[model samples]
Target: MSALIDRFNRRIEYVRLSVTDRCDLRCTYCMPKGFKDFSEPDEWMSFDEIERVIAAFGRLGVHRLRITGGEPLVRKDLPKLVNRLYHLPGIEDLSLSTNATRLSKNADSLYQAGISRINVSLDSLKPDRFKSLTGGKLEKVLEGLMAAKNAGFSPIKINMVVMRGVNDDEVESMVEFCIKHHFTLRFIETMPMGETGQSASSQYLNLQTVKKQLARRYELIPGMMPGGGPARYVRVAGTDLRIGFITPISQHFCETCNRVRLSVEGTLYLCLGQEDKMELRSLLRNGITDYELERTLRQAIDLKPERHEFNEEPSKVVRFMSKTGG
Candidate 1:
């Protein structure tokens, strides 16, 4: 009843769980301005329900759990959930992806509760541009990052989704920032997801351009992965901190896709770029047997796409990345 595998023989060992769709900030790339007002708080999964699902996934060979959201820290009692997941027997890695606005006050508590790693969404280094992109105060995010580090979260990962005209100029500066601060900086290629289709049209900066721009300043060195994750690391010429790239568009990793997602609404998404999902909530509420749940998981994995045709067009992406649980 605990078995889980896809047709490609990639074991489903990682699960990204969306705790809440509610976020304080209105990021231009992900959600529309003040979209939270339209969101119903009751639609989100309860902490207990999420824990039950994580336990089930853990039994089925899902050892790594990442908590994401419109912003995960937006959810109350997050450290309590982190502690629960931390003590789960089979769960080896418990991480979080957040905007870091709230972490300034909660980072210490989260670290104490045993959050293994953290990826902060910081799109721009400039305070004004940062405010424009995320409708958030940049000072808060920086403060959060500092707090996380001071609180003893090592090897912090910073995600900077690069758009051609927007913050591309800050690539080198980000590299320097990561290196100086000793954080693992990941420059992500903007995915074709967003309400406005800005992901497709707004100067889609690919990894090639990013690497070329970085090569001028730093000697890119191939890195070894201690664990199986998408970030292809390279040591900047003079610094010890490594910069990574998640080129889902340029360098597709579908063949080695070892992850699944649990949407905040309790749907299971096999792929991030696709909308076809299974309603786990229905089965859970209907008192579906564990065996039946196991069967349903296998069926979902079997139907997982070989690859996402992201390059097709903006219309091709069936769901936005925010809803897909990143």
Candidate 2:
């Protein structure tokens, strides 16, 4: 079987597939206020096209798939899509990243379909602050989280983007909450992606600092988790809950990047911090054969940059994180 190996010898075995760019919440960091520039429904790849793309990747030895979105659950008949991707040959694992606002209604179906793991974005536990940050009801997210847990999802992850003076004060409290619920916690450092992200750069708190503060309280023993993302994990001394730190700024993990992102419009993004990409939707719609699609994918992988210039060139990327898929 052929493998997607880049120039740097990084084997690309994972793909973060964005099913839709439409999200239910208007998070301040993700979607700008009054942001209306979304792709038309006709522009998105149909379910069959998406499946064919994944199968092509699967044949290239890409077994791990993560379904992302502005919020994946907002897409209609998502479980049906999940079921299709799960049965694709060579697919070893399937996961979803969501805001959990709609998980309450879709958790059972999604779990039964094939999603064995999930990553929920929850930045604040306070209702008012949650609404202020994400314009979402905290209770809805909480309910959705509980539903996901009850549906038998293992190693549920809570992704919290740590910002200075904004939600940094709740680090310990968030840890406590995760410990109580047996969910893994991950702290992320915000990057300058687009307009909103550039503005939010003021609140960019370094994860190294956050890790130091965490060490003052808990004995963080370094460990590894099953999911194939770029998070450095540590097991909390006394509990089963593991903590992960995703430091894209202070410590870029580009050297070990083994994944690429595919936008809903079928644009394959080679790097999160770089704009190098290739459009596959047109090729698919143009009646390109499966062999031709796989060749295009390999060509796309050849364009992957050695590393992103987020630190040196914070303004390099002008697209919103929502458009890039989580």
Candidate 3:
């Protein structure tokens, strides 16, 4: 089988597919208030189209698939999509990234449908502060997380975007909470993606500092985990819980980037920090053959940028992280 290789020889094996751009929460760092600009329902790739796209990638040796959204749980009948992709030939891994507000109700169905891993976005443990940062109820997210755990999801990851003045003080408490629950913890450094992201970049706290703080508390032994994303891992000396650092700013991991993002509108984003893209919806809707689709995908991958320019030009990309599928 042929593989998708870029000019830099990075083999593309993973794809972050956005099923929807609609999210329930108005997180200050993600979506701004009263943000009404959303893609039309018809504009999103239908379940069949999504399946075909993934199958095309699968035939080209892409085995890892991550379903993301503004919050993936908000999409209707998402488990149906999950089930379809789970059984696709050559697709070896399937995961979801959600805010966890709706997980309480959908966790069991999702787990049964074959989602092996989950990444929940939880920035604060304090109820009021959680609401202030994400305009979401902390209890709802907490309940959803417990439900996901009980449903038998292993290595459940808690993604905490550590900010300086906002929720940096809660890092220790967050780690304690993750340890108590046996969930893996990952710290993400905020990137200036769009207007909201640029505004939130003011609170950007370097992960190196956070790592130093963590080392002071626990012996962080360098470790590795099973996944295709760009998170560096460290195992806390005395526990099974692993901590991951996604330092896009203080440190960029673009050299090893092996994945690309596909927006809900069927646009393949070659790089998050760059606007290079290829429209696939029109080709799909116009009766493009599987062979043609695969060829188009290869053409798209050939244009993947070597690295993103987030540090050099913070405001270069103007689209929100929500629109970019987390």
Candidate 4:
């Protein structure tokens, strides 16, 4: 087996493919009004094209694939794509990250189609607070979560991006909610994605403070979550539901990072926080052969940075999380 190592000396084994740039929710942190003008519908890659790219990467030792988007469920015929991805050789695991607003209707179809796991984004528990932060209805997302559980999606992961004074007060409440429902609660640190939405002036509740607060309420025990992305696993004492912290800004995990991202527009970003990317769309449209596509995959892997500079020089460059396939 050929192991693909980036410049960082970290072996790349995971790939996140964005199915679309379109999303229903207008989260303040994600985009601005009138973004439709800037977003072009023709930029999206077709399902067959994405499958070809996945096959190319599979040859390069990428076995784990996660489907993400502005909201993956918003894409039509997603289960078809899931079924296609599940059949790929060496694909040990296939998962998705969704906002879960429409999951109530889509969960059963997705689960039956062969997706192994799911991560739902829920920033606040309070309906009004959630509406304020997400610019949408909270009840819809709650129903989606319920539907996912009913569909028997094991290890349901809930992602909470805690911004100080935004949803920080709900940390303990979120933990209790997760324990009550047997879902993994993951806390993520907000990063400076771009200038369009919430910027660095917004206070981010550091992970240390979050851990200290959670420690006061629950006897937190360290643990591991299978098929990792960025979250550091922990189990709430006396409960089965796990809690995870993804400290990208305050404490970077670039050293252990093992994933590569492909934008829906067909740009393969080696780093989530950096703007450096390799365009695979041109080669695909030009009818590049599979063997040549594999070569391109290796070229992209070779260019992966040793680490990101967000910790020391966050202001040097900018790219939105939505655009970066976060």
Better of 2 and 4 by lDDT: 2
For all candidates in order, the CA lDDT equals 0.81, 0.94, 0.93, 0.84
| Residue lDDT tens for model 1, 1-326 | 55687787888898999887778787776777766443466766677767777887877888888889878887889899899989987899888899999999999999889896899999888999999898889999999999999998876999998888888889888988888888988888876676644543666778888888788877888875454468888887666878888998888888888888898888898887766678887677678876677777778878777777777654666455667676
User: Clashing pairs in model 1?
Assistant: none
Q: How does model 4 fare in lDDT?
A: 0.84
RMSD for all candidates, in order, please: 1.7, 0.7, 0.7, 1.4
lDDT of 4 by residue, 211-308 (tens): 99988888989999898587888887678978889998778898899999999899999887676789988889999999888878888888888777
Any idea what lDDT model 1 has?
0.81
Q: Give me the candidate number with maximum lDDT.
A: 2
| TM-score per candidate | 0.94, 0.99, 0.99, 0.96
Write model 3 residue lDDT over 91-200, tens digit each, in one string: 99999999999999999999999999999999999999999988889999999999999999987999999999999999999999999999999999998989998998
Q: How much lDDT does candidate 3 score? A: 0.93
Question: How well does candidate 3 match the true structure in TM-score terms?
Answer: 0.99
CA lDDT, candidate 3, residue 221 = 98
Residue pairs in collision within model 4? none
